[model samples]
Target: MGELDTFTDALDYPVYVVTTAAGERMAGCLVGFASQCSMDPPRFMVWLSKANRTYRVARDASHLAVHTLRDDQRDTAELFGGRTGDEIDKFEHIGWRWPTAAGAATAPVLDDVSAWFLGRVEGRVDGGDHVGFLLSPVAESPAGPVRPPLLLLSDVVDLSPGHPA
Candidate 1:
C-alpha cells in the first residue's frame, strides 16, 4: 500500500450513492469521498470520478441526490459500484422517484435508504482525477425507524469499480 493508504486503510468511511439527471439522461454511482464541509450554510461535498458517467451527466445537472445505504444493502452497492451506466440503466433495477420537492426534482431519490438528502450543486472544483461538488441541501427524507448499520468502505473493498478512476 502507499503512504496515504496506510492512514486511510485504518479508517472505514460510509459509502454513498449519488444520483443526477441531465435532460433525459440519468446516472448514479457509489461514492467514497464525501463529507459535510460546513454547518452554518449546511454544505456537503461529494467527489466524482472524471471518468464516470455520473460525472458527465452531473456536469449539466443542477441537483443531485445522495443516498446512504445500509450494511445489508451490499447488493445495492454492487449494482451501482460494479456496473457502468454507460452500458446499463442502473435505475431500472432500483426503486426511485423524482423528488416532489420543488428544487430537488433534477435527480431521482432512491427508495428504502437509511437516509438521503437532495442538494443543489452550488459549485464544482476540479480535484485531480475527480471533481468535488459543493452541495447545499434543499430537501431530505424524514427520520424513519431506528437506523441500521451503514455500508462502509471496508464492506465494499473487494468491489472492482465499473469505471477506471
Candidate 2:
C-alpha cells in the first residue's frame, strides 16, 4: 500500500478546474482525476469527489467546462480547490464569464487558463467515493507551446482541501 502511494505520487500530471451550473447555482472545483476515454467520438471524463460542493451541481448539469492552468496560475487552483463553494462564490474572485445558452449551458468559463474545453454530459458512473462523468466534446480551445506550463499536483500539494476527505 505504501509503495502504491509512492508510485502514484511519482507521476506528475496536469491538474484541471472543472465547472458546472444548474438551476440558479454554479460550482467549480479542482480536479485531477480526468482523462480522454474515447478517440473517435472524442469523449472525456472528469471525476468529482462526493465531498465537493461542485459535485452536487454537476450531478444534473448538461455540460461542463474544464480548464488547464499554468504554473503561474496557482491562485485559481487555490481558490477553487482550497476553499469550499458552500461558503463562498468561487467565481466572484476569479476572472470568469457565463456561457451562452447554446454554449456550455450555465457553466462558468474561466478566462484565465492555458486551455479549455466545453463537454456535453453523456453519462455518469458511480465510482466508489467519486462519480465519473463522461463527456463529449462540444467546443475546445487548443493550447500552444507559447502558453504557460501545465499546473501539477506538486504545485497544489501544499494546500489543504476545503472539503475534508
Candidate 3:
C-alpha cells in the first residue's frame, strides 16, 4: 500500500454507470475511469476492473450504454456501484426503457439519467488490472426536463464495491 492520501484525491473525477446487454439480460456498474478519447472520429473510452462481474459480462457485449446520474440519484449510484449484479438485477429497482437500435443489443436507459450515450465497441486494450474499451457513440440523448446536476465521486463515498476492492 502507498502513503495515506486525502479522500479528495479519490473524489476528483466524474462517475458514470455503464451498462451492457447480453442475451436476455443487462448488467451495469459505477465507473470512474472513463473519458472522451478522441475528437474527430468521436471516441470514448471506459476502463473496467477485471474483478467486476460487470466486466466479465461487458467483455462479450457489442454495445455499452453510459449514463450519468442526476445529483438526486445517489441511490442509483449506490445500487449499481455497491451491489453486485450477480446477486440482484439493478434495473429491477430502477425505472428504465429500452431503446431500439439495429446491429446492437439493448440495454436499459434510465428515466432519470442526466445524459446517456450508446456506443459500439470499436477496440479494446488490456491495461493490466483493467481493460480499456474504446467506443464510438452511435446515439446520444440529453435529459431535457430532468436536467439535474450530475452526481460526482464525493457523493458516493460510503458505497462499497460489490466485488472485492
Where in model 3 is the C-alpha error above 4 Å?
Answer: 2-11, 101-104, 143-147
Question: Candidate 2 lDDT, tens digit per residue, 1-165?
Answer: 765798797888999999999998999999989999999989999999999999999987998999999899899999989999999999889888775534435578898799888888999999878999999877777557696778998899888989974
lDDT values, one for every candidate = 0.94, 0.88, 0.83
| Best first by lDDT, ranked | 1, 2, 3
Runs off by more than 4 Å, candidate 2:
1-3, 142-145
lDDT of 3 by residue, 1-165 (tens): 545466547656678999888787688999988999999999999988898877888888887889988788888898999999999988889888775653444566777688988888899999878899899998778448645678988888778889864
Return the TM-score for each candidate structure.
0.97, 0.92, 0.88
- Candidate 1, residues 15-101, lDDT tens digits: the string is 999999999999999999999999999999999999999999999999989999999999999999999999999999999998887
Highest TM-score, which number? 1
User: Considering lDDT, which of the candidate structures 1 and 2 is the better prediction for this target?
Assistant: 1
User: lDDT for model 3, on a 0 to 1 scale?
Assistant: 0.83
Clashes of each: 0, 0, 0
- In model 3, what is the error at residue 151, expressed in angstroms? 0.7
Q: How much does each candidate deviate from the true structure in C-alpha RMSD?
A: 1.1, 1.9, 2.5
What clash pairs does model 3 have?
A: none
